[model samples]
Target: MDTIISIIVPIYNAEKFLASCIDSILSQTFKNFELLLIDDGSQDSSLSICQKYQQNDNRITVFHKNNEGVTAARKYGVEKAKGEYISFVDADDIIPENSLALLYKEHDNADMVIGNFIEVMPHYSKKNKLYSPQVGRFNGIDYISLQLENKLYHAPWGKIIRKNCFNDDIFTTPRDIFRGEDLIMNIKLGLNIKDIKIVNTIVYYYMIRPSSCMQSRKPTLEYEKMFDRFLMLILKRNKLDTKLKKSILSQRIDALTGLLTEKIHLDKNDTFVKMIYSQLKISSFDMRQILLKTCLSHPSIFNILYRVYRKLSSITT
Candidate 1:
């Protein structure tokens, strides 16, 4: 019989948790999947670990290539995958034994199946109590709205996507835009897919490492550019109604605000921050008009107000 699913795990410097991730996939109740371990030029012993697993498991395939990024590794995996359904797993994370089985069971009903995940901290592993519809199918617009609202996560790891939904044009963004690649890619996939299913089961375990890319304090212009382009793309979609466009615009503005305040530290004096501020001022969406104007016109005052807002927000939460 042909492979039912192809699981792609992009490996970088995750030697500490690689074995556990591989073990989780190997122990899955669905035994008819091939595991593709793409070693993205890790400086550590990650490649050796992948090779060791490849030797032990006949279904495991290992590919070694120059360091490109997770996006490139995933593209390579998809190119070589032969399964009817495709799923991704980060090397630092693990999925439940029934994760693949449950997703595959629903494969015939929808183009995509998304499962819930728990955030596992370094010191304490806590199961996240997230509320999601028990089992619901949605169109592309509603699915994207759920994702924008944070009800549905944007990561590729916890979802099972049918191979037919992917085309040659997916994941074409520049490799440097690492922060929100999953969001952009999933948006593209959601746009193409007709039916999407939400499964309330907690299937994947996401490790919240302090040094993860999402938590990094380093400034990168690629993330701002990516978000800008994402918003523009969504706005240009003629099929989207005014209500959906407004919802998407509002969510994207919030994302841009976080980029400016949290990641970039709101340094209006910095050249990159200034460039971002200028771009936000001329954004097509009116939702960000006032905030951008305030920040650009009186940065110091805006900073003070922002600080107060954060304090009040913390208190309310």
Candidate 2:
């Protein structure tokens, strides 16, 4: 029997929180779902934990594979999934019991359903207070625009997508880049979806750990540059409206600015700094105009000015 929904979790060295994550899913109010836990060469107890759960629950399926990245694990899980709708969950995060039920209820006549999420820190929890659209249906372009504008998040874990919206041919080619893979995947999926439903309910609990890749300070200029080029290609390929294109460009510029600011203290002659300078040149027309007006024609000048501004702002605050 085909399940109504399939939840795909890519597990890698998540022994600390794996059991809690699985338990949250098993305790969901909506029971007609299959859980696919893909263990990506975890050198920890995560595989044993998954096996323990699989022994008890028939709906839980575990697949162990070599050390591929999350993208490959998810693609493999999608291939094995036999559900009408698909959802992704990070191995260290938890979902409310009513998550599936609420999302499934609003899946009518929609290609995707999106819900809100809360961020759980070490000792404190913060709800994402971003303004979600009212409970209504939105077209693909509008949805993409909202995402680029940061009104909607680009993370894949807080949404449910119809399996039909995916093209197997495109999905099979796993992305090699790591930094912005979620945003790229979501953009690709959004291009295929016609209508999406937004639900203003907090369904996911995103745990913020210091050891996560997102928090890593290691600089990888090549991956970042690849992501920027990929975003540019997506913008060029999609027949988006003027407003949407502008919004996407603005988002890219903002990301570049943030990255530049973070690396401003590094040596001006560093390779990473040089690569970022080159990326900024091609990021967008608006960014270039801003740089020109700010008298930051050179990357070193820009970095110095930004660092001084940050210091002043911190002192004032």
Candidate 3:
């Protein structure tokens, strides 16, 4: 029997990018694979587009579900998949044509195979060079550590994972923590992977749309639960390294600053916020790091000034 790969895409209202995303996967050099398109109750014409493709392609399977969310959609896909290895693609992104073939080649020996990505902006594209001109394999624990530190990606889109490595519990994701779901899942899944193969070759195209929720969301208590969960996960570890500790601190600072930037009217003495502030021993290097992170969030002069103003307003006596 051929080694079949399952490519899962959780889609909502993504009419414009849906066709291209599907086409890229269909055009993959590897042939023995199933394309699972989970339509998470889209109001747009996304379902019709998926059905049209399904009629002609036998490998395409379309599942229409009520609007749950990406994490739920992915869990449903995992339950239905019938392949030796699994991979993921975002509805708004494009996968490289040779990605499946490349990953499949290394799947036999590695529990997970990772490929680099290209960030596609409206007018320009940037090639992602996660590593310098080479391919290598490392222990899965190391990969998880790097990913948690934000040194490598935590998203599951660019990986091919062995199906047998995970138990059913691995798919469970907290419904409210949308922002950090990917990182959480990757960390849990990474624990099961004994060996990981990383290829520097481009295997995915990440589409950067103009409107991003990260720029506008208020990030209430429920939303901020991700940061809390992250802290707990890191703190519970028996062997906490210095790099991971810094990553936790960075996340805490980012969370606090994000709320401040949005001018959220939360209690000043809230335990979580107070704990984060008390722990913030911001060195010169950390200040520079914060500035770099803020700049990367948005480049508009008004945005920069607004954030700076809000940040200062919080400290006013």
Candidate 4:
């Protein structure tokens, strides 16, 4: 029987968790699938571990390349993917046994099949199991609106996408924004996506680490620059409506708030905050509308107080 799905696992220095990760996939009841293990120049025993698996199972193909980022590894896997359905799984994460079965059922009618994921800690610590809401079938308008509100913009691993969703032109190109590159990649895929599904069944296990990007110290300019690129992508698409425009803008404000709050040193004469504020005003993001209608409903005084608190906190500590 032909394989229906291609699971792309980008391997790095994750030898500690690699065995269990592959085991979960191997244990899947749905047997018709190919596992592409791209070893991205791991200095540890991860490469050797992958080699052992490839030797044991012909269904698994191991590709070794020089030290490149996760994006590059995924791009390589996508280019070499032969299955009709394509999915991504982090090397350190695990997939539920029924993940492929449920996703395949949903993919029959969906350009993209999105499933819920639970965040697991070390030693399989279970705290706050997370699952996505039933967003229902989304048209183009719903897709844009849900994305800007940060509701539908889930992790890349939870979804099984049609291979044609990423044509040669989209996934092969190199993007400048290396950090938070997932946002732009999702947007690019979503622009062409339709008949999407939002299921509550948790199909993915997301392992949290203290050294992950979300926990590390970063320069605010990286985020600012990335969002700037995101806005440019939005402009070029010309598909978002007025409501969706407002949602995107509101999120941008929230992003700016965090960027400015971080205690990072800037250039002697750099005015990134000022530049971001200027862009916000022209971006036509109506925060007031979002605040009145959503969870961001804070009074003007609260906004002022929060700003003051951040400024003082930044200086005192």
Candidate 3 residue-wise lDDT, 229-273, digit = tens: 754654466254454566666655556556655655445467765
The TM-score obtained by model 4 is 0.78
lDDT tens digits, residues 1-317, model 4? 77788999998998988999999998888888999999999999999999899999988999999988887888889988888888999988899998998888776568777888877776445575575565577764466566656776546798788887786444433455545567666666777777677777788888776545355546476667566666566645665645465666556655655543463433323464444344444234454333222222223344564665568645653
Cα lDDT computed for each candidate against the true fold: 0.76, 0.76, 0.74, 0.71
Question: Model 4 lDDT vs. the true structure?
Answer: 0.71
Q: After superposition, how far is residue 12 of candidate 4 from its true place, in Å?
A: 1.1
Kindly indicate the candidate among 3 and 4 with the higher lDDT: 3
- Measured with C-alpha atoms, the lDDT of residue 135 in candidate 2 is 62
lDDT for model 2 comes to 0.76
- Candidate 1 lDDT over 62-143, as tens digits, reads 9999998888899999999999889999998889999998887776668888887787776545554343443688877777
Clashes of each: 0, 0, 0, 0
TM-score of 1: 0.78
Clashing pairs for predicted structure model 3, backbone only? none
Q: For model 1, what is the error of residue 293's alpha carbon versus the real structure, in angstroms, after optimal superposition? A: 11
Off by over 4 Å in 3: 123-136, 211-216, 220-226, 230-247, 253-317
Alpha-carbon deviation at 82 in model 4, angstroms: 1.0
Which residue ranges in model 1 land beyond 4 Å of their true spot?
A: 124-135, 213-226, 234-243, 263-317
Estimate TM-scores for all models: 0.78, 0.79, 0.76, 0.78
Worst 10 residues of 3 by lDDT: 126-135
